[model samples]
Target: MAKLTAEIKESLAATKTAYFATAAKDGTPNAVPIGAYKLLDDETILVSDQYFNKTLANIKENPRVALTFWGEKGGYQIKGTVTIHTSGTIFTEDVAWVKSLKATLEPKSAIVMKITGVYTIKPGPDAGKKIL
Candidate 1:
């Protein structure tokens, strides 16, 4: 697993919105903006499933996922494997965390992503290069 750098950790906190991508069994790609997401540690990223239908379904079909976000400086894309927690301590914690940010929002589940790769998404000569 690739550990998140200090810069990327700061970027995640500063980023207002992040894009999460997954694929269906048929290879259909799905990407959506997720506002309720955070880094649990260096490698683990948790995304609260407020209201996901196709996204949830796609996760079951394929575990591979990617998340991209941009801060004031630049953007990054992280590729990883996913594990969905429907009912557990993680789920409970996620609901509480999301509720603290968005009181009225209902959290259905938590999507836990284990970072395996990292890449620069910023537009430059280093774009698309794997940093980890």
Candidate 2:
């Protein structure tokens, strides 16, 4: 697993929304704008699934996913493997976190992403270059 750099972490913190991409087993792709996500650690991210339909279904079929975000700090693309938690500790924490943000929002599941790769999304020479 790749560890996120401080710069990337700061960028993620500043980002309001990220584009999450996933693919079905047959390679059909799905992308969605996600606002509920947080870095659990340097190598892990927790994403709250509220209104996911195709995104959740694709994850069940294929665990691979990519998340990309840009902000004033910079931009990065993170590729990871996912584990969906509908119940247990992770799910419980997710519920609490989402509720803390807004009582009306319901988190159906917690998507734990174990980052496998980190790449630059910035333009110019190093675009798409793996950073970690």
Candidate 3:
């Protein structure tokens, strides 16, 4: 697997929140912010607590998900495949790598995303202009 860029990593870690989008079985989409996540590996993401979550249901309905992380410097919009594991052991092996960060995470809540593609979010004032 390829590695995440420093900017991408920083964007995710630097912020306490992230935005994720997932689609229902019918392809209808829903998105919302998650308070926490830890990078399991260069291509994997671990999120704690997957309950009462639209993303979780969407992932159940469709494994594909998109995560968008933003920071003061910039932000990354990541497109990846997700596996929502309700069990605590979901990404156990990866936790050691995130011990310092784990101190600030909510236990018994976890979801992992295997990143596949990424893009940058740069909204400009003129971005809203529609051209057909």
Candidate 4:
């Protein structure tokens, strides 16, 4: 697992939305905008599934996912494997977190992503280069 640097963490926190990408077992691609995500630790991220249809189905087919976000500091693409939690400690925490943000929104599941790689998305010579 790759640990996220402080700079990358800050950038992720500053980002209001992230582009989440996933693929089916047969390699069909799907990408969606996500706003309910939290950095659980240096190597983990928690994402709440409020309105997921195809995304959840793709996750069931393939656990690999990529999250890309950009902010004032810079941009990065995070590649990881996910575990879905519908009813457990993680899901309970996700519910509380989402409720704190907005009581009206209900999370269907909690997606825990374990970081495997981090790459630069910033335009330059370092673009697409793996940093961790």
Model 3, backbone clash pairs (residues 3+ apart or across chains), number: 3
Query: Which portions of model 1 miss their true places by more than 4 Å?
Result: none
Candidate 4 C-alpha lDDT tens digits along 20-96: 99998889999999999999999999999999999999999899999999977777999999999999899999999
- Candidate lDDT (C-alpha), each: 0.91, 0.95, 0.69, 0.95
Every model's TM-score: 0.96, 0.97, 0.74, 0.97
Off by over 4 Å in 3: 91-109, 124-132
Clashes of each: 0, 0, 3, 0
Give the RMSD in angstroms, all C-alphas superposed, for model 3: 5.1
* Residue pairs of candidate 3 with colliding backbone atoms: 48-109, 49-109, 49-110
**Candidate 1 residue-wise lDDT, 12-88, digit = tens:** 88988999999999999999998998899999999899988888999988999999988775679999999999898
RMSD of 4: 0.8
Write one digit per residue (lDDT tens) for candidate 3, span 59-115.
777888877767766677777787666445564643433455556543444567887
C-alpha positional error of residue 8 in candidate 1 after TM-score superposition, expressed in Å: 0.7
Residue 28, model 2: lDDT of: 95
